[model samples]
Target: MSEKRDMSRSRKLFITDKLMRLLLVGAASTSVLVVCLIFLFLFREAGPFALNPGLGKLLDSQWIPVSFQEEHFGVGPLLAGSALVTALAMLVTVPISVLVSIYIAEIAHPTEREFLKPFIEILASIPSVVLGFFGLLVVAPLIKTTFGLSTGLTALTGALLLSLMAIPTIISLSEDALVSVPYALKNASLALGASHLQTIFRVTLPAALPGIVAAVMLGIGRVIGETMAVLMVTGNSAILTASPLSSVRTMTATIAAEMGEVPFGSVHYQALFWIGIILLVITFFLNIIAQRVLKKYGMMK
Candidate 1:
């Protein structure tokens, strides 16, 4: 009787596990299906434009889309603007995020960590629109006054806001990575007469480097995809310039600000969809690069 009962229980457990695995696979497949559908939709809308004669025009530096004379659809300015804003934002975000993570993970007391972690996470929950407004009304004016600029809505302004938006994600992920470093490693370092800082710099941080790098990459992803905040603060000027203090616009801002007003089935509409495809490709490659980095890190370890 006991042998028979054991066999039945094992069989039931195996069936349950198999069912769970199938359910998870179904869910993952559904997610992939949704992404494929989105890509297909964008491609369908933008295919003609991609092949159109304007492909040459799209490579130019200017972006004059609405004119009785002729319309230009160059993406150079938008791409440059995005690159500048994201690059500047990362420069600000990465150092501060890593330092904050270090403080939260290695230095803070338990009570302080409890308070700081929730507080920092709450920063991410604040809506982008609200942050945009804050940037417009508060930071922009402050920047303008400080720099004596003609207007506050500059790429620098946008980059600053984006960095603010990205910090929480980086800090949270990096803190988790730092905290996950094995206690044995730290103890061994201390036993070897290394100071706490030395142990953290030499042992703890290296062990957690992979996760920290992942956090920064994810933060870049977060900053790059932001729409409203950059839209409102970037002055929406399609200018090809590298100066962060000047006004510029991003691919996301272009799509967001003009998509609704653009005539359906028109070249302008197709251009917006094309921009969407570009963004999708950029993000896809970003994720791929992130995976590669993680894999390389794993191998190095």
Candidate 2:
């Protein structure tokens, strides 16, 4: 009788497990379906403009879209500016983020770390619009005076603001990764007479490289997708420029600024969809690379 009861209980538990798995799969399928639908909608809207003869015009630096007259759909300059902003922002963010992470995870005293971590979290929660406004009022003027640019809304200003926005993400992720490093490794290094710094550099950091890389990837994505803050500070000039001081417009800003003005079913409108597709592709690529790096790190350990 006891054996029969045990078998019945086991059967019930197995059925419950199968039901849970089915529910999880159903949720995942719904998410995938939603993403597919969005992509399909964007492609449908953007396809006509992408196929137009004037689509070649999008390669030019100047963006002048007229509703009645022949429309110019040049997105190249905007795309280039966006890339430059994200790249420069990363350059600025990476060093500071790594250092901050080091301080938070490995170096700081317990009391200080507790205090600092909350402040950092608070910084992360501040609205991007507030930052943007601050940049416009304070940073832009300072930049204008220092650089002697007529307008403060330049690529450098945008990049600076973006770096500020990205730093918290990098710091948070890197700190978590650093904290996950095995305690045994640190003790072993110390047992051999290595200093804390030596152990961190030689052991902890290398072990946490996957997490750091993932943080950077996430930072890049945030910078690339940012719209309002960049739009407010970037002078909104669609120009291809290698000069950091020059005024520029990023792809996200362009879409935000122009979408309402462009007529529906027009080539100009569809070109915006092309820009969306480009962003989608870039984000997808970064996520894939980040996932692979994380997987490699997991397997290595």
Candidate 3:
């Protein structure tokens, strides 16, 4: 009688486990389905323009779509602007974020870590529009006066504001990554006569490199997708230039600023959809690269 009861219990547990596994699989599949639907919608909407616009014209630098007689839909300027702003933002964010992470993870006392962690979380919670307003009202004027530029609305202004927004993400994730390094490895380094800073540089940081790369990639993704702050302070000029002082517009800002004005089914509307496709492609690749790095480094299975 006891053996029969035990067998029945085992069977019931197995059934329950199988059901849970099926439920989890369904949940995972739903996310993939949603992403596929979004890509389908974008391609469907942009198909007309993508087919009609000759490749050479589409790649041109000019982007005047509102002109009645001559409407151009070149994406070169928007892509350049996005690249410039994102690159500058990363330059400002990466070093400061890594240093802050190192201090918080390896150097800060428990009490200080508690305070700093919450402060960084609060910084991340602040609304993007509010930051944009701050940029326009405060940072913009400072830049204009300090640089003696005609206007504060330039790529540098946008990059600075985007960096402010991205710092919290980079710092928090990077600190977590640094903290995850094994205490054993650190102790071993110290036993070998390495100083605390040396252990962090040579032992902990190497083990945590994958996570740091992932953090930076996530920060770049965040900055690339940001719209309100960029639109508010980037001067909205669709001009191709590498100089940080030059006014520029990004792909995200283009969609946000002009989507409402463009007529439905028009070529301009279709072009905006094409831009969405481009953004989706960029984000997808970034995530894939980050995941590959994590997998290669044995940080993720």
Please tell me which predicted candidate would have the highest TM-score against the true structure: 3
Q: Which stretches of candidate 3 lie over 4 Å from their true place?
A: 1-27
**TM-score against truth, every candidate:** 0.89, 0.88, 0.90
Please provide, for model 1 over 1-301, each residue's C-alpha lDDT reduced to its tens digit, 9 standing for 90 to 100. 9999999999999999999999999998998899999999999998788677556767866888889998889888898999999999999999999999999999999999999999988989999999999999999998899999999999999999999999999999888788888899999999999999999889998999988898888788888889999999989999988998899999999999999899898998998888888888988888778677767766223
Looking at model 1, how many pairs of residues clash?
Answer: 0
Q: Write the per-residue lDDT of candidate 2 for residues 1-301, one digit (tens) a residue.
A: 9999999999999999999999999998998899999899999998776556646766765677764765567778888899989988999999999988998899999999999988888877889899999999999999999988789999999999999899988999889889888899889999999999999899889889888998899889889999988989999888778888888899999999989887798777888888888898888888888878877777223
The stretch of ten residues in a row with the least summed lDDT in candidate 2 is 49-58
How close to the true structure is residue 260 of candidate 3, measured as C-alpha lDDT?
96
Number of the top-ranking candidate, with lDDT as the measure: 3
Give the worst 10-residue stretch by lDDT in candidate 1: 292-301
Residue 231 of model 1: what lDDT?
97
lDDT of candidate 3 over 1-301, digit per residue (tens): 9999999999999999999999999999998999999999898888887567654567766899888688888888999999999999999999999999999999999999999999988889999999999999999999999999999999999999999999999998888789888899999999999999999999998899999999899889889999999999999999989999989999999999999998898889998888888888898888889888877876763
Better of 2 and 3 by lDDT: 3
Full ranking by lDDT: 3, 1, 2
Off by over 4 Å in 2: 1-25, 54-57, 67-70, 299-301
